[model samples]
Target chain A: MRLTTARRSTLFAGLAIASVAVLTACGTASGGGDSGEEATELGDYEGSVSILAWPGYVEDGSNDPSVDWVSAFEEETGCMVESKTYGTSDEAFSLMKTGDYDVVAASGDASLRLVAAGEVAPVNTDLLKNYDGIFDFLKMQSWNSVDGVSYGIPHGYGANLLMYNTDVFPDGLTSWSAVFDDAAANSGKVTAYDSPIYIADAAVYLMATQPELGIENPYALDETQLAAAVELLKAQRQHIGEYWSDYLKEIQAFETGDSVVGTTWQVIQNSITTGNTEVVLPDEGTTGWSDTWMISSQAKSPNCAYAWLDYIASPEANAQATAYFGEAPSSQAACEFRDDCEAYHAGDADYASQIWYWSTPIADCLDGRTDVECTDYAAWTTAWQEIKG
Target chain B: MSSAATPHVTAGVPQPRDTPARRISVFLSQHARVRLGLLLTAPLFWLGLVYVVALAALLITAFWTVDSFTGQVRTEFTLDNIITVVTGSLYQTVTLRTVGVALLVTVIDIAIALPVAFFMAKVAGPRLQRILVIAVLMPLWASYLVKAYAWRSVLAEGGVVDWMTAPFGGSSPGYGLPAVVITLSYLWLPYVILPIYAGLERVPDSLLEASSDLGAKTWRTMGSVVMPMLWPSIIAASIFSFSLSLGDYITVNIVGGANQLLGNLVYTNVGAANNLPLASAIALIPVAIMIVYLTAARRSGALENL
Candidate 1:
């Protein structure tokens, strides 16, 4: 009996270990498969498309009855829309790898990773009619394209602008210095965006202030440049009242005067009812994000996914979507559908040029340097923890 | 079978029904080891699968690496992530800060809970005790996010704390480590109080009266008698507060100013950075800490109270 019990226990242990091995192997094996090939021509609509998108991007009237553009697309294309919202790009990345989603709205940070992992296929712009109307400046960027092959359709873009309370800065601050070199002026009332990506914001500041550091791209930071940025952030950390990842946290902080100066999005500034705050581009430019709509490599509904890409990029749908999300629309024609387009500087290439869109930092330097290995996202994460310490 | 021939059966009494339940009881009573095994099987399987296996998987993942560009987990065995977590100054500092904050929160909770629990368990009348218990439990029913956000407003500059303290030339601590500690203490207070309250209830009132009747002062009675008996309870309560505080990221995110704890490091690596191996490695810190804490608690006989 004792020998049999021992044998049974050994079997159970072996089964548990085997199950773990299977689970781990599944994770590793799912990556880098041939995504088959990009569709050269559209077939019949598969009658449905499963969309994975940022919140408010693919509204189907489920959240707010009136704030939906998806219904119209569904009606016109005869494609049933089943959508899931992800809170962050990382979540969207993992969700896309499940091969459950037909189309994904990927930010620059997630787009390249998806492309590299073969989770998404390249887009043939010829197959999309609305692709032509997208802003020229928004097209074929490093984030959305690799080796000149476009991977997705441009959706919307927004910058992380510097916002300050008028009560704190009566004369108004003109530079990112207010949050960096002069952050001590505000002392414990200053705030900043809370993310590893915010490390690029500090790098952006360093590029303008200390040009001797030879920092070119905010996203492309070699070991030494990243160290410089980390040091600068460590200094700024002393004055930060709090770092906010949630928009509501920042808005409440501003309203209560706990945070008098911080990086904010245009949407957050608009949501502040007190009118005591204002957002500026600042002299040093800013970090921003641009989203793209890409079809999953294993899309079950390729035609419908293509249809979604075309439909969402159309003028009226794009206007409603971008306006609701508080970002500049992807096209000049989209601006024609809304009166407040000028407020977001829609279709303005010059303003867009001043924004450095968020991109996943990799060992391969994004700034086209061949000599030094740039720091990756993991490194930034480590540095961010240290900075916050 | 004839009733007259059945041994140990009463001649006049009706035979007990030989139903399924009777058979089951008869079988279970006779095979004691089998019955015990049957009773434990489901829970043992649940515990093994959900806790042990999941933990083992996490530990295995910690030794693996990720392809930085693709965010894909590479299952090849490598100690790089664990090594980084151990040797990295960032992890060390965050771990220290986390432990410090957790300890402070536990101490504060204990300090607050002792008096309140003493009142509830000893001083208060039965009706009042019931009311106080209900009141202590009321906050737990509300969503945790709601409470954290409410505290955010309460601790905001020129908000409730400031408005109240302004008369004394003081101000809100604002969003920072202090706010984090304060909010966490508030959040875990009920957990601390209940354990201590239950412990206090278990101590006989007659014992307290006898101590006093023996010519001991009230403070002397509490210090010499009540406190020593309360040690296990205090340790049990401390376990709750300490582990809860150690694993908290959301409360800190809401009010911790620019601070990041061990939780935040784990969260950032998992959610934002998409580095699961590193996150798992960072997560081991709190698990290891809690293991040590639980071991110490066990040594002090706190597990009995639990």
Candidate 2:
């Protein structure tokens, strides 16, 4: 009975996906028809603007008395700010669909989905004085734009760095092989980011070591490429101490010697009280996020949204927000205000180019390959479960 | 009707006034079944809407699929998610691991609680019993996250466990499956202990005395009399620990050391992947297990105590 049920379910799943492909094509075409027009010019500021953002992006001194960028913007623009924070990109996407928020800070993974769903409007860069001051490398990427049409202004960016114990590697490591090829050296002490997206990290490693795989983009993987990446991860899993989704868990693991090596963000590294750990961007590069500040298509206060976007992109506000969040500021001018800009490799185009910013994987290959279908996020999710098992 | 007709009182005591509350009370007394239904309506409605309806929706969603790019739920029917969840070796392995951890937690709690509860119910003075119950309940007042983190530190290398064990040339278990089991067992211990304590309170002292008078030794009396009577409560307590452990993901993440459970699979699909259909399908494993478990427990008369 169980065997029959399993076989029937698999058959049904295949049929469902086949039917969904046709439905999705029609849905996207219709969704595109209603793409809200971008505001051509800014008018009088609306009295209030509702903002949805990641935590620490729009602080108004409520969390800390010192972090008060939103207050200054509200005073200067005459647009009262009411900010709500979302925990994940998926959450931001869902919240934007309500058409309640005037502006949102969306990471690359979410920005494209917002544009595809017609939840955000195209930006008129001419209206913003600070648009030119932002890094040239950060703008008009596939995630933040479609067919060269800019969806939003770049906010900030960061990479997932390889962190290791100073005691474990006295000479310091330069490659991700410490966590991939030589991971067994730290057997039961190795760790990795606990998400399907982390598969890209493995792909990044594979690209360097096994160049014959013809893997162009970490996010774009055909079935064979994805399977190869999965095999590498499954091998790494044998040496893994634990997979960590929470930063505090990772920090604790590192502090108590539970995890000697793993993938981590710069912010997590800075938060570690113990001085035994150091982070490095491996030679193979790493996956990272470049967030964009977008205005809602159904925004009630488009003018206020415009003003908030421009204000946030300005050097001082950008510095304050990015500095608090532990990421590279969007503009070189913003780096002048912060002392730790060097640590984040701010304004380094070469360093930025080495980073493959996170873009949601879809059926249409991100690398622009049309000959074969690339594995989507759903496929990765299934594969991640299998890898851990 | 007679009371309404005769308004004036013949006795010295004034006749009771026919207030709105009194009128409703009189009507309710005349119709016991109506009163019973009225009393049950709110609770029954809540159960149907929140529990039954939500469960049905989850099951329905399990048969659906989501658009990979847009993250929207497509209502098109498919057997794919259910098939993947059932046939996938990942799900099977996680299910077995989760069940093993849950069973171990339940058994550990039963072992610890039986002695602690027996002392609280039979040996301790009434004041001490109250204090012991309060002590057992105090940890529950603290947040679950705080306790889990506390355990993480205690079980860390060179931590409390290590410090205490070092004198005897032993070390802490460190973070792994053992850590997960230890933390879960501690968290669910109170839930187990209280039910058994309540069961022990119901066991009359006279029964024990009578068994002793009938030439039954202490061990014989406990095995022949107390064990059979306490069986239902023990089963009820096991259900709490077992099910809670089975559905847990957070504790495992914090301390399991490279492990994932059924809850983690469901959580990742829903939160990270945004595949609600897949998550719902994965969630069905624990629900199905619980149903099978509850059926077995019901045969032991544990459901009545619960």
Candidate 3:
């Protein structure tokens, strides 16, 4: 049954041709869906408003015994609310694209892509009465706006910090390099945010050491910049005991001392501190991501969506949610309760100066790359998969 | 013997050709009730129609492409989506690893299961067989996710394994590969055991006694008499274990750590990255492999039966 060389070559040629035909057929089929941008029809209001939100964004209806945000919103605006919690921003984007969701709380990274895809609509800021109270910085942020059309209202934000088990490193953590570069001390005991977007951290680390890599802004990565960052992560992955995405798991990893040092969100740090860990703002400054409440283009009830956005961004709601969720407040008026908010706020004059907020990379942005010239979300995703692999 | 011979003779005889009315009477007499029953049942008719057509439609949708930026299913033809399944190095690695792990799990199941199944069918009392069946089914009754997470703590640095091995200086117990293999085998063992038990149950006691009467050794008698009878069950169980493990993502993801499988890739791509097209494409690789394996296994079983 052994095939001759010529026969094997002929068989391979046939297979190659058949594979090409299948790919060509797929290409044609994919193009067919691109032709029509059928106008989104509204007024499916009576059924429900399917919202994809962060896990803690919705109160646990059974345990918390609070008037659920959805129930309260439904009572106020009369649009029934149906919500599903998402573990990551990437997951929310996938679900929202199905046209089954009416609203989503997209983060700074995902909001633009959603707008570009027309999955989410540009919020009429005027319709949102409480939009005025939202911090000016969050309102016109580059990721949330495209061509002066704002797509989302400010929601929640938290800084990514260097967290360590207080028991393991009582000396107090100071730098990102201690975890990324100096691994002998913390070998197999470090974890990081298991995200491709964490290339920003690598860029942060490289900005200090490999100055020639020319990485200034972590998010604004060029192909060359990305290649160097990818190499850094490939090295870091070797040191990581686990690349954790879940906050609860991160806490568990920290509490068990399995992960000694990690790049963590403030909320996760807060959770871990309840155990034996302490978080430190790195000497090199820290990076943060802001979450935004965006309305879907296919929203069943715009009035209700606007109401919910306004209610959430109001002084009382913003202050309460920020205190509860362990993120910075989204409202200016909420800062009047500065003493109460200080524990959660990363923006106290000393802390504010230390944290660099996330800004979308656009053409001529200070992150050292032009918008169109920089790597977009798709490239980041593909690179992330490759990096993890 | 005369009556049985007469019946065979009647069956062998051909009926004479007849007129249209007579033919109608003959066909009606043979199949009228069964045809009427099929026609009268709307649910069965619909089930048959949907099973054939709807499930095919679902499988076809996996070929559909989703826009990376927008996350829209581009109903257009594009093999660009399937690039990973066809050519990606990581996917190839995962695919091979999944197959290897699945084969290992199947073999482990067959080794442990055959004896247990034999004991239940041939050796155990009726009550004992029932009790053993209950014990085997107990693991399947627990929540699958709960079972997987339970293995995590056991594999953790200072968890159960480390504690036990500490006296022997097995410091910093590594549970990555070992944990995944053990957990997956545990999860799908029932898939093998149940089928093998059923197959062994089908073997007549007469066959085993005949083999023994012919002065065959215990091992030889079991092999010559039992294995051939159980070939179909072994094939069926292999198909179950192989297919289940091939497509599994959760247990492996929780246990495999950096050693990613096709399931983990599909999960991260589909859930974490929102890259459905790529996920769907990667999903098809295991599916294609499964189809090939199952078909080959089925054919071999049929040949063995003949």
Considering every candidate listed, which one attains the maximal TM-score? 1
Off by over 4 Å in 2: A1-34, A97-100, B1-39, B304-306
Number of clashing residue pairs, candidate 2: 2
Error of 3 at A54 (Å): 0.9
Model 3 chain B lowest lDDT segment of ten: B52-61
User: lDDT of all predictions, in order shown?
Assistant: 0.90, 0.89, 0.73
Worst 10 residues of 2 chain A by lDDT: A24-33
Q: Estimate each model's TM-score.
A: 0.93, 0.90, 0.83
**Candidate 1 or 2, higher DockQ?**
1
Arranged by DockQ with the best first, the candidates are 1, 2, 3
lDDT of 3 by residue, B1-306 (tens): 476468777787787778898887778779978667766778765764466334333345456666555566665556675665678787777788888888888888889899999999999999999999999999989999999888877777788878888999885444355667778888888888999999989999998898888999999987888898898888888888888888887786666655677888888877766766677777778878977886787667643552
Interface-residue RMSD per candidate? Answer: 2.1, 6.0, 5.3
Looking at model 3, residue A377 earns an lDDT score of: 61
* Model 3: native contacts recovered, as a fraction: 0.43
> Which is the winner by TM-score between candidate 1 and candidate 3?
1
What candidate 1 gets wrong by more than 4 Å, as runs, is A1-29, B1-38, B304-306
**In the order shown, what is each candidate's alpha-carbon RMSD?**
3.4, 6.5, 7.9
lDDT of 2 by residue, B122-212 (tens): 9999999999999999999999999998999999988999999999999998888999999999999999999999999999999999999
Residue B152 of model 1: what lDDT?
Answer: 90
lDDT of 3 by residue, A1-389 (tens): 59999999999788656644554455424221221222233333354556788876755365476624445666766766777888777777767766677678888667766776777877777767788877666667766777777777888677788888877878877888877777657777888787666777777777777889776677777888878888878887677777777787778777767788888877786665447777777877777778888887776766556666777787766666666667888866877754556665634546654555554333243454445377766677777777777
lDDT of 3 at A336: 77
